[model samples]
Target: MGLIAGIYSIENKAIDSGRHLDKMIQCQQHRCQGGEPVKYINKQIAIAMVNPLDSIFSEYDIPTNSHNPISGLYNGIYAFTDGIVLDVPKHKIYFESNGLPMQDNTCSSIVAAAYQKWGLDFMLHLEGEFSCAIWDEKKKRLVLARDPFGHKPIHYYSNNKKVYFSSEIKGILDAGVNPGIDLTSLSDFLSLNCIPYPATIFKNIFQVPPGSLVIINSLDIKIKKYWEPVISVDKTISFENAAQMITESLKEAVKRRMMAKDAFCFLSGGMDSSAIVSFMTEVSSSTVHAVSVGFEEEEENELEDAAVMAKHVGAKLHQVIAKPDSFFDMLDLMVFHHDTPFTDTSAYPTFYAGKLGSSLTDVILTGDGPDQTMGGSGHYVFAVKNNIFANRKKTFQFLSGIGAGIASALSIDPTPALFSKIHRKLYRQSLGPVHAAYDIRSYFPDIVKKYLCTKNLYDVHSAHNPYRHPEAWFKQAQGLDDINKYLYADMQFYVPDDLMIKVDRMCMAHGLETLSPFQDIKLAEIVNKLPGHYKILQTKNNQIITKYILQKVCENRFPEQILTKKKQGFGVPLEKWLKQNNGEKIKEILLDPGSLQRGYFKGKSIEKFVNVFLENKGDYFFPGPNAIAGLLTLELWHRRYLDFI
Candidate 1:
């Protein structure tokens, strides 16, 4: 819910760079823990912190990066940690952590605790949604780190001689220096909806992977992953012990997050969200408030389901009526806060939900990690299904060749060509790497791929860009089965980069703090390693079930109807909205010649996609709608970031 930025130089050069830090901090001043006088250590290091504007302890603006005996800026280390720290010393150290020890933990105490326990490795046990940094006075080094789940982000750029770090990417660029796009990451946005670890949308600048720490001392920089999303079984926990284990873990998770004053929940009317609401109601001492977003489009609306959960929990439900007009209208603001474009139709709703919830409380618990941890995504099952038919790849390829040969000789033109294309696609999909399967499922078919025209895609760096072919991520899931491998990718790539990015930026944009009990490190470690089948089940009646263990735990908690209910997650009415007014909003933004002239896309190709979208044709690629959505987001981003600059 806040931002931290600072500079560390190789040469012990006095930095007049307070200007850069000030400008960067000002960009995210909403989380201003107020301004502090700049402190320099031996003229080589500088540190700054900004907390939320509306924090209760507004007077404690200048966080504690304590002064040592040698000089006031001891070690010249400056630190900013967001999210309440669970444990710290009883008495005050560097900066007053608002009040009494454990109850009101400040970023100062959190870092101070790390200094005490792990020395430079403070990020390891420093749990919760936090991005923290420290300057080791003795070693004359700077360390930057992020939380295990990456709900909070920390990005840094090293220009060989100096290292620049920040809580958001724009904070680094706003210093009047645009590093330009990361030439290697051109297709990352199109395929994954985000850039992977150690890489940002901008070049040179990089994000710290979740569960990792980066250290810089006189330009000798090293980034290490202290933790990874590795799934391993706990031998003590048997199949019969799972239910109670899940119950206890949830209880503790809720207790930790609900520690804040006046906490609330966002009820999505789905199992994940409703379960959070139900848990909070039982564990919280006070009345828990719930917020839900309702769409005018009946198919996209879930107010009734939310109401059902609200009544069950006896919580007051406040609904935000989300309309297409409002969602589109908020694009400029979203791009400004996110500093990047995301096309998940749910982004706008998540934004509106946070805006609504911010009115009720500063901290809201969301259900984000269940699908990632418990193998709940339908894609996991689809990957499994693809594997089942993998053995038929060569057989299908031979038949496909025969069909094309016969059609060519008979003078059947497109029909034979189309058959060959489909056959090749199936063969590739069935036997391709899991990550390849994952990407292709979301990729526009190659026939329509000419629509993308970015210069970076054809450049020399393209081959090295792991995103072009994502075997790197799949290969990392070495020991897991096909389903778990896909789940691991979802956890490592999709959850942190795409889903977490949306939640963090949108919620924080409104000055609200979101904590996910499901994403808690301890809870994730326990559930993620469970047997893959325990997470997903194919019932005797032919139904595919996800989060199998969780559903069993909630079987008696929610109504029977909820147990059998369809999976209705947080989403927008995009398909229907595009059809509204003959897709005028889309036409006005995406089909505009000026948009195509940006050199990122071919004008005619976009027109064809738009026409196909309007025609409601299913033969086109699945990602076509998403790609079309990204085009609007990109154009809007240009208006706010690139063009404005």
Candidate 2:
């Protein structure tokens, strides 16, 4: 793994690109701890990278083939890769079949050779999680590409004159791009709990969407999608056959990721992580090292289950307890690492899990992708059921109105203290299946956001629909079944933006490289095409099973308890923890004179909201612990990155 950053001057301005590149690299030194730093500079472009000691390519300089300098023959071609490229033997074979000469077996050389042969299409042939930056000196064009599933992240900022790109947002910030809040993106975050792709918290900075490339030239910058998930169902494939294929594919994925002699697996005792541990043991001759994190709260603790899974798999288990004592300290670090207003409470446990894993090994494996790809989330089941009711929208709306009228006539209040609960439910029921499904994942709806924010901030984003970003993806999944549509939208937006960002940043902060077997592009190509019912199965007895196919794959290998166990998601007890001393600290920061003067939120509304939640006087419809966490993180981010400056 490595960190890459660079600057491309469209006007070829007299600027010191190398100096900016140096600061970018220096800011993200944690990513390249004990690694080699390399840079290439010219009049129009400057490229810099830091490859970890264990990276596949030790040298990232320009291609050295004199006989066939590839594109360098025209002028000079430079390429830098961050993250792994799996299936090296197959890549070499493909290169040989295509009659492409390679200077060496390293990944950098392979990329250069492939670019020479296929030009821009070279990324389509690579099967791994990576972000690569290629500069064409001849054309004076700069290209940045990310892997299909976006396992690696690339954040870039561009003005009309120059473009700056990096593996992390902090890199670009250090490269002289002043940071400013994007209110629309902040609304997106407040509504959806995450800022979607192509839109980051910083006004001008954006992420290179997964399976896409950003091409910057002297004229303009353009983005092109190189790959995407295709949902062409094969109706003839039987359940047994599909399960077998998934099992084999997952095993192969695990085997491919076990390239390092010392690698550990994050075992959460959930099906995803448990399945990964099971496969890791089967692929490695040595005993697998498993890591887990739990909180003091019993409901949030999964260490016992993780230990049980580890023992069953014959792996050594390492466990860590996440405490409230270090909560604020950890939050400060998390906000710094995330580089945005992130509200994934699970990131707390993930951060500690990565820290524990990094203490043991550099490379760590996780079970991250299957939930979106294979329909593992319980929310999918709810979406399917909700869609059934949502189809009878006319009847539902009539009944809801009649019920409300009858309650009013009888002077009965269903939600006396929380009237918004009834309104929210009725509003959601009025939406179609796709919108309803989207609402299921949203923390705060747009209407509530209006009340939460100041008029200035609210009015600026009022014209923009919070659901606009996700709706576009849902529209793309038009003809698919309801479940598939939800899965497709989630795969396109949620996984890459929220889940992947959480895992990638938390782990990378400690210099740990994480690999997700379920994120295998090959596996997704096969699984994504399967019918939705195969993933969320309905039995004759009226029982719904989520991730049915995956359970079937693990039926014999995993213990019966493990296979039948309900999915306890990687969640932390935010409510319980927020009531602790840290809660008071959060209140102090969020309600501080400086914080209130920011004018992003209504002071009175926020004070009342925080007081109600912290005092446990809020009703069911009130903003929960997650929303409070969002506010705290946003304020902390401002202090750490923006306010500090």
Candidate 3:
């Protein structure tokens, strides 16, 4: 709904905190279109925010609570919020229970009151997509917290003398934090197509991890996690009961997110989005609007399915067609909005969908979280099957090692074909269940990336292994089954880093606000405790079904075609587009002298790789269209964020 930024001088430096805040807000003007910036400043700190025109409190006549980025001063605590608090009534009840009645029901007032009573533990009682900054005036202490699933983003930079935080990276950069590309994060992007949390492309700026708080004072800065997905199976809960609980939880979640006068949904015709639309119709008094995007390629288009779902739900559907010609025009803008190198090709269609939806309403609902939380992704099935195979570790490793040795003895030269056929088998067999699942999700395997990058770039990042991030997450799910372990890691790393970032940046580029009902903390608390088999059901005939419980909930309510249709994920025809004339432009930019001069990749290796992909001659070793897109976006990001700045 808005953006927040601020600076704190640890040494109490005599700087103009208000002027610096003005510069930071100016950098994020796109996110605050139609609203003025608000600021609270002192000698040691400055906090500022800008709410959108359609903010939740816009209709209120109260002087202090008329808009978001609302602030409150109570009991020596000052608080500011960028998004809504869904459960304000719950907080009010708690305050009354403690014999400390609230004077106002505004989000900032509630937050300030709660912090005054419970201190930092107050974050555990808040429920919504928000990022808040609270300053303890008496203690000279500042605390920043993000919502559980990171629906709102917060980035910060700290040093011995000063600390800076913002809702977006550009704000911090504009506040005079010199931007230097973090090579380790560059390696992460090349491997995962997105950088993991707490580390951004910029070395100095870092994100505050989701479901966590960052406390900075004159002494030190500390981060603490207040929430995480817990795995605890309920043995007595029947499948029917679980499905019923999911149905109710989903409806409640949708109802809570319906805070705006006019809200629409991003319907991909997939079960998740369709379910959201169905629930929206059930809960809303007004007609629901659904937005969908399709591609020129027949195989990639889902307009027909989307129309079918829209008719079934009795909602008006708005559709947009994404063409290759407009790809180049939106490329730089996308990169700039992301503030980093993000190459999820689906972002193209997502951007167009948001643009269409923004014309109708500022708030948009999406079906984003279930794939990771409810095991709806196809990769879950792949992980389960691979885990089963990997369970027989000794036998599989022995056989695969012999096969690799035989291929070596035959002088296969480890060519792309042979490596794809032989070495990958060895690689998979040698890894544990968690590692195997991670490998299956990687955009580029570590060995393949080594051949692609220059020795210097590769070696500089050698000590900073990107896989460590996922491995750490995997370790947290230690007691769970392999499937749950993989899912937990995805929830912790991939969902917030890649999927959420793509949706948030693409939609917010046009000043749109998005909410995901499936990401509800209560819903996840129920779903995460279910056994792995409940999520990925296996039939007597050995057939695999992903999200079985969700399907059961939708069995009678949704059409059979929608319930049974294979999940064609929200993606674009990047391969097809990359083969067109635009591919030549990509090739030229990647191989241009300016690009090669950066020294990220060896000139000869990159030249051959780009040629191989454009000529339709790619192999396992050669880069594919997705990898090429990553490289192209990286170059574009450099030109805009690094080069221009």
User: Which residue pairs show backbone clashes in model 3?
Assistant: none
Clashes of 1: 3
Q: Considering lDDT, which of the candidate structures 1 and 3 is the better prediction for this target?
A: 3
Weakest ten-residue segment in model 1 by summed lDDT: 65-74
lDDT of 1: 0.69
Tens digits of per-residue lDDT for model 2 on 1-645?
Answer: 578899888898856887899899888877755565667788888887776522343234333222121234323677777777776656767777777644545555566666666788888878777788888877778889998888889988988788899999999999888869898898888877898888899998999999999988989889999998878788888999999899999999999988777759999988899999999998899989999998888987888888889999899999999988777778888998899978888899999998888888878899998889778787787766545423655787677766544443443222225445555666665555555555666666554566678888787666887777767887798888777877888888889899989998888888888889898877987797799999988778768888888989888778766787788899988787777874788688888989988988878777877777877776544567787788889999998888866
Task: Score each candidate by Cα lDDT.
Answer: 0.69, 0.79, 0.80
Give every collision pair in model 1.
Answer: 31-51, 33-51, 75-137
Query: Candidate 2: global Cα-lDDT?
Result: 0.79
Q: Which has the better TM-score: candidate 2, or candidate 3? A: 3
- Model 3, range 113-163, lDDT digits (tens) per residue? 778888989888778877889889888899999988888888999878889
**Alpha-carbon RMSD of each model:** 4.5, 3.5, 2.6
Q: For residues 1-645, write the lDDT of model 1, one tens digit per residue.
A: 566777777777777677887887788765432334233434776666655421233234333333211222223334556554433332334334542232233445446545544566666655677777777777787878778878888888877666788888788877666676654554566655566777766778788888888888885888878888887655566656787788788878887777566769998888998889888989888888899999988998889988988898888898998887655678667877777776776878898899898888777899888888887776766765545324345666566556545543443211124554454454344344543464455544332342344454534334553444456666787776566666787778878788888898888787677888888777777786677777887777756788888997788778765667888778787766656788788889887777878766667656766776776653436325666677677778766766666
Q: Which prediction has the highest TM-score against the true structure? A: 3
